[model samples]
Target: MLLPVRHSSCVLSIQFRAHSRFATTRTITTLASSAFAEIISRSSSKHQIYQSISSDPFVNLSIEQYLLQKTPEDSNVLFLYVNRPCVVVGRNQNPWLETNLKALQKHDTDIPRSGSSVRNVLYVRRHSGGGSVFHDEGNLNYSVICPRDVFTRDRHAEMVARALQKIGAVNAMVNERHDIVLAQQPKEFAKQKDATGIEDPFEESTPQALKVSGSAFKLTRNRALHHGTCLLDSPNINNLGAFLRSPARPYIHAKGVSSVRSPVGNVSAGLVSSAEPFSMQRTILSIMDEFSRLYGSGHEVRDCASRLNMTKSEFNAGDDWVAGAVGEVQLHEIPEIQNTFEMMKSTDFKFLQTPEFTFSTFTTEEDPRLRPPLPSFLPPLTRISIRAKKGIILEASISTSNDEAIAQKQALHSSEILADRTLHEIDAQAWRQIIDSIVGIDYDGQQQQQQPMEEVVDHLTEFLCEKFGV
Candidate 1:
């Protein structure tokens, strides 16, 4: 048994011996058992273990420590989303063959910067009622992570992909978090996917045409479903879990057998051909954009799924409405932040976009009650902006009360209210009062005001009525 690393907590895991011709599934099972055994034996938290694994200079010690120290709260559940920039040879795939690492090195640096990349995995509070995801951020990177025991690995990735599917992805499959693939799928898959896009209804098909830009993933869409393309069989759960829970170096080697085809296979070319699909992120944006068009950009969230062709029951609601899935969180820009809590603090113009209303359902075919994981690492609740230029960043959050997770899933396949306000487009008067309150130094952001607060609301209402006119 491998001993626990210093400063790190025990993480249970499963691995797929992806790069072998004769490698039986049993071997991977053995590996998974060992990984889980190591985790269970540790009797410590994953946070403790992660600290042992990471030593980044940019992160805060306490927060970093908090991230590494796994609590006794939940079992180590490896919820993996393969969004890696270069191919990540599964604990078994040969890196050289699977990834053109040297080529990706340049774009790898170009990948967008986010706080969670410090360790390159999403983390979730144990049994925290949800999981976390490592996002691709539009780059071709694999999203991989481990969480406390709330769901299985097979189910975890499927849950993520399925949620992604809700957004209309025709080829999104949870090939293990560590399981990496070419930047693009095989040729046949590309041809089929492309042809379907051109022929299908404008709203029903994915907008992207398939091209081999090194590599990318396939998302399964509803059309693909109608044509009968499925994930076939679940991969070795133990192997998948371990891969998500552990970093590659110490656990998996770079070299492997030439035949290391992934059992955590992607959607086949055949599948992509039949299932013309919209990407989860893309679908959410389309709906949002349309909502914006109907109500004006950044209006309140309502009847999004109804706008689509699917029925309401198909929405696949998890435990709660996953606001984080929307990727819509926002933050205020720097100059706008007053240095001295002054009566009037202003410097520039700006806006913030919250998350998409729906993505994937994080539960497995078995445990749909379990919610999809949260974003790999929760960002500083919202983004900060300047007057249309560069600026410092800040955080903001949505109360659970304001976001009904289950209701959203139900609404996906049918018609229901997702949110009362999109929180993107508020009335100019509301903006004025918020600015005034901040300027007048009377109220704090998001907090209710006393007598003047009512006045603030009235002006905001009137301003929206007069200005935004929604």
Candidate 2:
């Protein structure tokens, strides 16, 4: 486990050893408090830039929140980070409706790497409000914290567009939706210029644009935070849709935001060149240069521009404005950040923070959309509906066409048991037990009725387990 560091001049380091096959042993060295203090004190600086060396999503997000809350009102800050495989949902979004929880639970060892290991994809709820997004080592996340008075939805997005253009992604531009997309180069325009002998990157073309970056935000009384993801060269790009497409979407009526599907492309796709291979480090440097130009002081701006060709490590080491892992460790020392970090990783915040939603096997008065066909194993005319708030079942009902008195009584009992229970807490075994108790079992522990009712119970148990990922 990662531990918080205290203020001291001595070097603080820890070795994390994991016996599980999913993780590898590694040594983590944290910077002393003085280095962290210098970075934090720069809140008053006209322009500040920091990058996280840690890939833990929780740690990076916690640090981002700290900067947003602690930075001076007039200061402009830039934070860059890369998280390991994880699905991040908006603050008000429902995880069950936005992500494939079952897929996330399955160990993913298919990511192309030197030494691939089984890894569980994480689910995170961000502090900002927007659609859900996927993050990985190849995806670079940029966040800008600026005064609310001067903040606009598209200002930083436009800045990122300029950065992409500077790096030879000439078709990159900010779309009306505030997302950065690479306009498709029409076949006719592939080899020819426009009427003025110049191509407009922002011009709307015929084919659909390929989105490369998604933007989201959080606005405070004085500070406005705009953060976005830039896809570079993710190995799992082809598998992104599977993880974001929730199995419960058809049955769920959610009260929160839903992700708008888009055809995504990588920024590296536009960086083809015979002389130089695609480099994420170079792309990040370009973005940092643009940010510095827009907000850095004269000397700082020049310094950033001069380091464009330097490696990321060299740039971080030589630049006084850049803080790396040290800043990440010191962030945990702040009470507010520590609390926010713990809260964000807690079960209550992950599941209970979800907005009210309903799951119905059939159409209802309130949610009258056409329903999908139920499993054939379910009894004819069988219907199930559950209403939940903050992940706790508020009301539930189950019924079948059967009019037998015992069946009616069992249905009512099952519904009663479902009500007031937490959706995600019900494991497959527990759910099976609940169904068995209602349907009745013989002395030999076999289901009493091995026909319609037994099949119904089996189907419900499987459905709940798969949908909730318990």
Candidate 3:
């Protein structure tokens, strides 16, 4: 549906030189001498700006995809928005290996419960390849969508670094890996510059620098998108740490992008000025202006920067701009796009679509305190390995190498303990079914009634006992 026009008089057609070989004339409806005009310039190559009204992570991601697919070949696009608190995994990443499932379980427990319904932690996977990152209101996310001809990851990163610098981060710089880092100490800055010849203070070796932004990209035959998270005032860094920590399952092996752990700082920490601390709206406006300055044509910069200011509420409601000529803002309502969004939200698609990889579960060396005390009959330590494919157990083995005699004795003990190896397969299949069902439900537990953790654990134990004929 076309947006309702508020003021007919506000509509104006802006014309400029078209650069594309296929088109000689192009016109955009935008406010004269406004940011919208600059964004939709008649120039051969131009950019468009769209801000999502909803904060639903699923909806936001879907909107992103819609914009990318619908973008005009001659025009680039920019999206600025935040998502509800959730953990987004990269497309190729293994959910079991990249995230702390145990922590997620506890996280689910921490959510406030009402009646039989329980709020649950959300897990979203994106088409881009990057280590998992946490998202919330405090994290501002932006996406640069453009054709392959004009898409440059390094230039976009530099633009983001400049924008951060404009918002009170005087020392912000883009590192070799394209992360935005803040260098507080002179030594740290010097060490980083000398090492990589880049201004980044958060080089891999620089321990003092704190990363404020991390970027990733997705490319298509004709288009490309670079999106990233900017930490401004994350409410719970501890939750970020806990959820992003390596999984306790060490026996699993997969080829995936691993997150580079680094000290992170909130952009709000450096967002202060002589007059007052900068607000999120102000920060957003500053970034929009910078984006216009970098990507907009010379004929549009001054007018665009001067008029780029818009409050969060104004952007969300969009009564003024969408209907008028201030900008070309399109809210996606395509049924196909909506269906894709719903499919992506499903557990079957998210977990089962992953590349083939080995997953195992057993007591691993996680915390020293959690290690079981040494048994007198067995060696001081025993290592067990269980291999599985798509949740089906393939092999099981327990080993000890304290000494030859100890190894032989341990093998004998393992035979007794692992007498019913087939039981492991049956138990694994049952547990997989349970997890598959749980994840299929809505995160808030509204769509399905979830079994209590104690009940689930007891059920698994009972299944195992029956399998062993105990």
Instruction: Give the clash count for each candidate.
Output: 81, 0, 1
Report the candidate with higher TM-score, 1 versus 3.
3
TM-score (all chains, Cα) for each model: 0.23, 0.80, 0.65
- Over the stretch 141-176, how does candidate 3's per-residue lDDT look in tens digits? 888887788887777778887887777777778877
Query: How do the residues 32-138 of candidate 1 rate in per-residue lDDT, one tens digit apiece?
Result: 11232233224432211111111211111112222223223332211111122212222222222223222222232222222122123221111111111112222
The lDDT for every candidate, in the order shown, is: 0.24, 0.71, 0.55
lDDT of 2 by residue, 1-470 (tens): 22234432212222344776565433222234434544444544446667677687888898898888776788777888899889999999999999988877455645443234326888999999998998988789999999999999999999899888877777888988899977765652342222111111333332557678889999999999999999877656656766787878889998988787776767676553324677777777778778877875434433443433222221221123433432345545577767888999898999998999998888888889998887777666666678899999998766554545655666677778988998888878998888667655221234344365567678767876767665
Q: What is the alpha-carbon lDDT of model 2 when measured against the actual structure?
A: 0.71
Instruction: Score residue 111 of candidate 2 by CA lDDT.
Output: 44
Model 2 weakest 10-residue run by lDDT? 191-200
Q: Which parts of model 1 have CA positions greater than 4 angstroms off? A: 1-72, 75-151, 170-470
Candidate numbers, best TM-score first, in rank order: 2, 3, 1
lDDT of 2 at 4: 39
- Which window of 10 residues has the lowest lDDT sum in candidate 3? 316-325
Root-mean-square deviation (CA) per prediction: 26.0, 11.2, 11.7
Which regions in candidate 3 have their CA more than 4 angstroms from the true location?
A: 1-45, 105-119, 186-203, 272-274, 297-332, 359-429, 432-470
Q: 2 or 3, which is superior by lDDT?
A: 2
